[model samples]
Target: MAVAAAAGAVGVPAAADTQTAGAGGSQQSDIVTLDLYNLTDIHGHIEPVFDKYTSEAGLSHMACYLGKARKANPDSQFTLLGDNIGASPFTSGTQNDNPTVEALNKMGVFASTIGNHEFDKGLDVLKARIDGSDPTHYAKINFPYLGANISGMGTYLKNYRMWQSPSGVKVAFIGAIEDDVATKLFPGTVDSLTFAKPVPVINDLARELKTVGGYVTGADGSTGTEKVKADVVIAMFDNDVERSYPQMGKYVDGLMGGDTHKPYYFTKVRGAEGNILSAVASGSFTDNLANLQLKYDRKAGKVVDSAAVRIPAAEVKKCGDDPQVKAVTDAAAAKSESIKNTVITSKAGKFYRASQEDANHVKGENRGAESTLGGLIGDVMKNSFRTLDNRPIDIGVVVAGDIRSDLATDSGKITVGDVFKVMPWSNEINYVTMTGAQFQKLLEQQWKELDAKSSRPMLKLNFSSNVKYTYDPARERGQRITSVLIDGKLIDPQAKYTVAGSSFLLSGGDSFTAFGDPEVKASKRTVPNRLDREWFGQYLEKNQNVQPRKAKSSVGVSVKEEPLKDGMVKAKVSLRGLSFSGVGEPRVEKVTVKFGANSVTASVNNTLYDPNAAQYSAIVTADGIGHTDTPADVSARVRCSGRAGQTVHIPLTVENEAGTELVGAVQGLGVDVTCPAADGSVAGGGAPGAGASVSADKTPVKVNRLVRTGAGVSAILILSAGLLGMGLSLRKRKIG
Candidate 1:
């Protein structure tokens, strides 16, 4: 269906990717060319933005490119890989993503796979948007949402829709979403849905199209009248890594992937039978479009060759935006500006979410660690829910994943738009009663099973200030949680406690299924759920000025030791989970370990290069007040940014006084003192450098230097004597 004449005449675009494959031959009447264009992870970016912090390419420019490309080749079909909506910006997000729908209608897309974010509200809300049944939204989407691996759509979804050329050369476009979408959504919203692995599903569909070549069937297996076999297959998945699914190239000529939001193209995936498949990834934020072309020979009934090129969104500048799409984007911007400017709170301190640092110390958002913002949100939710619902909730919980943005005022005032971006899902407060054992299970669930398709190996759930816990990641999964305390008291395993949070979390969102237990779900719901964003705004407005939590509510503490020795001892204590991301979270610089009243020198080797660097060693000695009969009290502490204390009392096992006694033998004014046991315990390899010890009753005094040898000591006395003699001569001359 793709015409060669409509293409090439437009000339090369600016900064177009140089990657291209399979040039065409001369005078080919039997050849059929199909042009396919795709975009992924738009996330409702509909308006052009050029700001100090960021600049978005927006839908108007994206639509301009699509219009020109499709017009140049009438044989083409505009399509999307995934992430057409949800997690949108203020312009579209404020209006329930209606502007995005309107913009997509102007682009004229044929079909799209479902990104995980599409399920943010639930399956029903997604359907309502797709069919334009909701009167509150904008326009009806002309594109069909396709997913071969997803069930519970009844008959609305399709697997592969064939596009036939004039001479009957058919190319089927197959769509399948990632398998783990269910885990990322609210439980009640998707209880009826089932998402399967897309790799096997795509393989099965390719095999059937190649061998069977029968009538197309609906999602429910209802066969349709149209019958055809694909001469070429282009598969779309909600993944960026082409290497992850090596077996995918069986019958596919090209692939488009999404959901890492990285801008990259030109990866070759090896197909079955040693055939190489061209893999192309467009960019997120509507920044680029992946263009793929295929040449099929009618005589051979197979695709002869294919090539791909990534078209950047900047190319639209040369051609300009489509007038109709630009109008919609501008309208959206105007509509949301008032709400965005409405101040929600006065000037406030910054609150930052968790982030991860790479080996080179480059940082980005990480949902695996706790942060000050998450803790504050948890407190806000708990207090607001208790007062509003008239319920006695023992604990409040909020996961790192739920917090999408931070609260930092650029204009010296917090706005509604800023708060909305932080809690965009508009989740409501829900209460569930869970026993202490189940709560422990939920805490243990932080270390989740690693997924090939997902990035989070561990997810952190931030609890209110009243809750404290310690975890050791080195331990087995279920046994990682060593202690859990609520309200300064050890949690009783049999006690029933009511916890409040988003309905998604209360129902075990993000795979924390302990909260989804039968007893927890069946608990009485005496009051109606309150929207979390409204409550949070009220909480902030009442306080006027907000500040981040100064210290971490929960900490990770563990100890590793060699055999115990009482005097002049050393030990390694693992101080981990201290390196949290963002300015608001405390940044631990060094750790200190104290034995009785004697504090020894310590050194820490914390680095992103090694996971074992969390283990810091400090020298502990029985030299001063540590010279006690009973075990000396050991305190492990940390010095972090903006604060100097996190005193964690840890137990130390010191060697008994029996072996440590210095055996003194006196004979004619010569005394022999034999030290205990040749320095073996916490000795040898990892001990810190020895330094002069401080007495138990006094502060440390810094000398110019330590005089190590006898020669150095004599040199100091000679200098002192010369100075004294010079002073006496000067005094005698003055008297004369």
Candidate 2:
């Protein structure tokens, strides 16, 4: 039963009035005010912690505010939108989010819709937690989880619930999640569940409640005996208000939205008939709670007025914590303290993750770009899953969003908690073999145009040490990737290579659909039971001391051509390079051209190559070029050189010395050289050919020779003598 509250207050409404007059004057206008409060996207933040503003944020403070509000308005009904748990800190995540559920139970959360994170551990685990079926670690949720659109195997959750106000006006609440849950959740989390469109389900349920009276369905498929006839219907969705309110407003009297964590209070959503519905959303991490007061007219069976009031976390004047919530949070924190404080290893220098400043400086924009932390994690993943099922992992991919925090800048002792903060998902590593073409497509997907009107248009990806690539944002979408190298070799589009990444990528999270292709997923292999956090911890422990490596330079080329007399062509090639370190100049060692079974090495035009600007421009003159009547293919290659040295110091395991410094290998970039055909005819868009292709020989060029010193010769002689003596002893024994 819904309890109504007194409407007269001194405060102004947050938005314009969303009320309609009764059709007839004879109908009695008995108005009752129902106070509804909502909280959303807490994400298991049980204890108070410093937010970006350096102020306290936690469930305890939220509970203090809730208690105060309920005391003032005793008829208030408290609800949650969803995303109460998952992707949480060590304190809550380690305990499987039981603390959050228990805290919510104590705080008297009436009902909630399922958020994407609720299925992070899969449907079975969610069911166990909700039903308290897991005797070992489980708590019974006092409120029901409502999902009207979800069906099939996990239909145990309620679709709707009915409550009647003290004034005898009934209100029905329906819950639903976004239709795209399958893509957002971890793979296999909701494989057996079917999510239908929210509109149809919400509308049908609303109609049933308004017309023939709806009944709540039990988890065990039992029918409820209580018939629910509501004068007002409210739909609670675990989706953003921008997406849900407009589409679902006509069917329900009010809406509770979640999943973006933005606060939107008392916005009126109008229907086709000019009927206005109220909607509200509370911000994430219990930062704010919304109080929506709906004035329902029993005679007209409609809401006469609606307004919302938001209570910010800072406004909670209470200094003490809720006793019950504190008890659960304290127990969880105590268990997490040991793990959080345990030292994983030590660091010699700062390992930086991508921050707003770093992203802006690196790419001149802020979507997400590569950083030192990304590089370190990529290296760790590559080394950990180098060989799986006898297949070598050629490249390791870690998306920019996965890196949560930077390593401690002080470079002192690194703790287990530090590593957990960086890679909190605990995602398992998986390997998939993809063709070179598919790999190129995978890289292309990283640069996304989120929407037509979005101002920010880039998403950067972190790659393993062995993988390097250059992209041109100025080029077309499929043509952006100018060059790619794997294992010091050019990526051959026709060749197949095994790549390693998290299950998130393999499950097609973040819209990297190239990895989630049905054929590629069929051949995916899990790297035993190793999780990303475990691998990173082990790597840190083994390395003992680590530091950020110097960034490498990515280079590309563009060519221009002019037709000359006597069947000749002049080609001007420009090589441009961008150093990720914001330093290190690029220099071209040599340039060569290949045309129609003929190869020519160009003369050294050292004057055009600029070390300061990191660009090289040269004009190559070719005689008797494009002389043939038939179209000929033309290609050019440039060998650019750079150096990388050891940036961190670590003790050697085999010998008593520091780790060896890395020697950066020479990289190459190529472009199709354009040439005019005989009689001044341009073939295939100014490039004289049907099969003109440019490629770089990624094989490292040996610049020096190895010399065996006296010690090395002596060791070989000693090994030879030992083998000879062993053979003689065996022969003597056989003769005897």
Candidate 3:
């Protein structure tokens, strides 16, 4: 069902396949069908690997699949859209991705575009990989990397390349990387390179190749020109299909895109001239191989029909590994085998790195929240570094994106390969001394509104066991964090402590500018000669058995009530919960307070609180009549508005101590309270026209004198005199 066939090539015949009369009334129709094998986001995974679903994934399986497709259709040409290297596993990345390049060469990759990851190391390294100028390899790359929008870097990259099919039809492939490569890449990786607008560059190149033909300058500065024009235009981009499809589709007959790691069997977009353009993206990591078949009318000089098919990795029947590709990957695997197989430790339960479920009832792992795996990694960082450096590590932080995979084996055994896959960056462990204020600032940067208009929300940071913090998503950007405690003690804003983290963070990666400030950078000290993965492995070996601690829930609530004038009471409620601000998770739903027979609800206040504020507060007023005599017991509850739908409650009491005019003030809330009297006076005295001074410990009582003029007053006086005389006569008789 994943494969879609156009013109019924593999199924029932369709009308498009039937021959028709020519435009000039001459019967002439000849179609040339060619197959294009596309792969993207390989990430230099050379050896055979298994996915979380236990399915076969890797370049070896991909090579096998490509071989089968090529055999089935001898005219098939293998191509890589982009992201073939960089951010790779140790097997390939350790060797500068040379093994992957060698494997790709053996698999007969014709051409590819430049992905953002290709610029990970620098432009010079990328050039060396392309030209094989580095001493690692004796031969240059077999395929050319195209970048039509790239400028100012160097002349090694070509804008377009033309390949002539067996049927004598020339196909022009124009390639371009993502437009925002500069933003996504590291600080100085692409400082000298310019990524021009893709649409105009692609359109201009297409026009030149079609009208003026192909021209290139020789190595000695001699210009060589070819008068041959391309019969069909195909555009390949190293960006998301949805972002590049419409523009590329307008000019090209076929388009291929990547970067999202998703597969599109066939997506037909209408062009500017009403012509249908077909595009496809092979999935990432050899999970699936995309096959695009194009039927070209040689005489018409256009692609008449197009179809796409997705061949899953599992469907590639076991034909053993391709000997040529196997030799390359096997050599790389052999170099890493010793470390890969070495047992580091055992886990009591599975440590997840990402979401791995389909059912709604099953809760998937979130990288942005406090996760068991994150906590485990953070603990390893702190404990290992502390042991090695012989210094106290107050806190350890790790970004969720750096953690790549999960430890899902039922056997509980963990290997060096497992750790490598989880942390493939090879980043060194670094330490920086910062004040609590600066540290809190660094934590606040974790949640940011990158785009005001988009739904994409902020990322969360993972902290170690020594750090505990609460955030209120209902609050504004800098004030989201409510409370921060280090080692069970509230952090002092002026106290200085050493923090452990990756060099990436020390250098201010992920917008953590607080870590990169000159003052903070001055205190940075990297652990001598130790990588993050190595530290983790050493820690695991020493521990032998490791299990993640149960992470504390970040949601909390507190309430305070104060008595006001005219039997009115104000309840201040604070909610501490993590929300994605309408991005991934919902915001705080509502906060309600119930006291006696009255219930009141509070809404979130839009005004941002101070950075050191404890919580987001909302005030609700309720009337209290009978509460004047005794203390009022109140309960406050908060609920989240997101999918999790969790809630928290706190009980508080508003007390008016006996003999103190019954002035009420809420207690057990996280905020200070002040009560005012009903007669526009301070409850603690200091009012105008006061009669007598009242003591702090006692209530002030007043008495009124009775008037004897009224009949009721005279009757009360006569009855009181008679009762006194009778009581005296009875006493005298008893005495006699």
Candidate 4:
């Protein structure tokens, strides 16, 4: 930190050092250096890290950064990627992002994408938040809130326009939030608006922006010059570039992404073919800002080149032990000290570090990062819910993606900044109701991906004494499910179940399709500001002896398979479904199946590869497996097996390997495989060989199954002579 300050002294001498001077180096006639400024996931950290009034001071610093950028170049453009609303601290959350918005508004944010948190309170409340102030309602801002790729004036606003520079250069900005925003957040937040996929939506917008002025007329009724279309495109969307950057880059010049809490800058190069594109992500976050310089060649009407600098850390003037940041921070320290000095009660003990080891939800036991940290947060969230209303949380579920860092043994000395670092994104908690069937479907999907060797889907669950579950990775993806209970009763597929989870999962974060069922809508939900901070406060209050345990492995997942090849395989396999009692327990069931498999599965587990049927398996790890009495308390591996056959009935049971049910079944497993050439001929373009077959006769016969002997397949006529003769006779009879 000291080095950064010294470097700043040499690198940034004065406020002028903040100014980004100079026109872009690329002077190509076809290039335009369009500098784009963006902000996202600020999390309402209005003050400096340690200072009391530093929050206001921090605001002034940001202003200085922005003012310098403007002074350096009047042509610079600014946009926001979202998540600037919900999950904020008391300062901004209670005030509904007013200060944050005012700050951005002051700095002239042209447009912003709607983030999932923007809908935390529902659309009406958000609308009220934005419209309450006259400046926001009637600001000179021409940029519209773009969502689902619908642009300008009509879809998000009536202005229906693109920002064109004074030199007649045009650029279109499209806004969109994560698709799951529909469910991951409260329905009240997005009451009626529907969201479409970002790619198609952006493509449609790009087309409109490219062609809006394609036709024009002169006053004399003669053909006039068409309006010059956009030379560059900026998409300020509340989606992560990590997932769709490559594809998204094709339709836009730059993607300012958010909702992931991680800062990212991506540049897409449109290939010789306008559709051909390449993209890369540039990271950004709290205390770190991405400074992007876009050099567009006005003559060429296109961006030639771009550069970005990531500010490693926030610049805050250091203070002595009584330093303001330290002072404010010390106050909390002093409280802990005073409490310790007054009474010598039983040691709270050091807070435990959660790793992939230990058992029990007990405070002293070691556990996986997700279990310990996630559980702690869930408890706090559940408490928050209780504080807000009399109704207690039925169950709390959150994906591992939401929790960025693990609690460490040394974390007992946690600081405000440290807490913010762990829960950086500050996503709001959302609730949705799903049926038992849908819940099972969601689990099946999770297993398919995780067992297939992708990322594991770990969710924090706070069950309401009514639900319990058990898992068996011992069988195949479909068969790994077992033992579900709800309200002390077995789960029923037809029953409705209430589930608590973040907006991300309900929106399919883990590819859990069942949760996205239209009927699985949200009910009572609250998007609290700074869920982690609130939880941290509660954690400190409850436990005095906090410590983190050493990390170790707990849950283990292994996949067996060969590298998979392209194409669909037709085979049936039974898969276990998850369910809870009261909601009815989900169970493993026999199923008929035919599906496509991904190549990544083969790459991960080549031994489990099925030559004929597409099959894959993988191993996943969950910490603290041994000692949990929690309802969903169990662990085992799921096995997936594939074989060559015309059709196979794979039983979905809690077993360790493929069963012997098909031991004596039919065994003529020869597969009819062919890779027809572009010319529609067999490989090598030769006549049918001994084993390979083609038509022997020129006349085509209607045959369902043709047998191959040598040279060609023996064709059997399905329309027998008798049937043909009978048909003729029927015609004759009609004539008579």
Model 1, 283-316: lDDT tens digits are 5666556676666666887767666565545454
lDDT of each residue in 30-126, candidate 4, tens digit only: 4344556566666554444432111122333444554555455455566666665555544444444555555555555666676666666655555
* lDDT tens digits, residue span 228-256, model 2: 67778888887756445556645588888
The lDDT of model 4 is: 0.39
- Per-prediction tally of clashes: 0, 3, 0, 84
lDDT, candidates in the order shown: 0.58, 0.57, 0.57, 0.39
TM-score rank order: 1, 3, 2, 4
Q: Where's the lowest-lDDT run of ten residues in candidate 4?
A: 727-736
RMSD of each: 16.7, 17.4, 17.8, 16.6
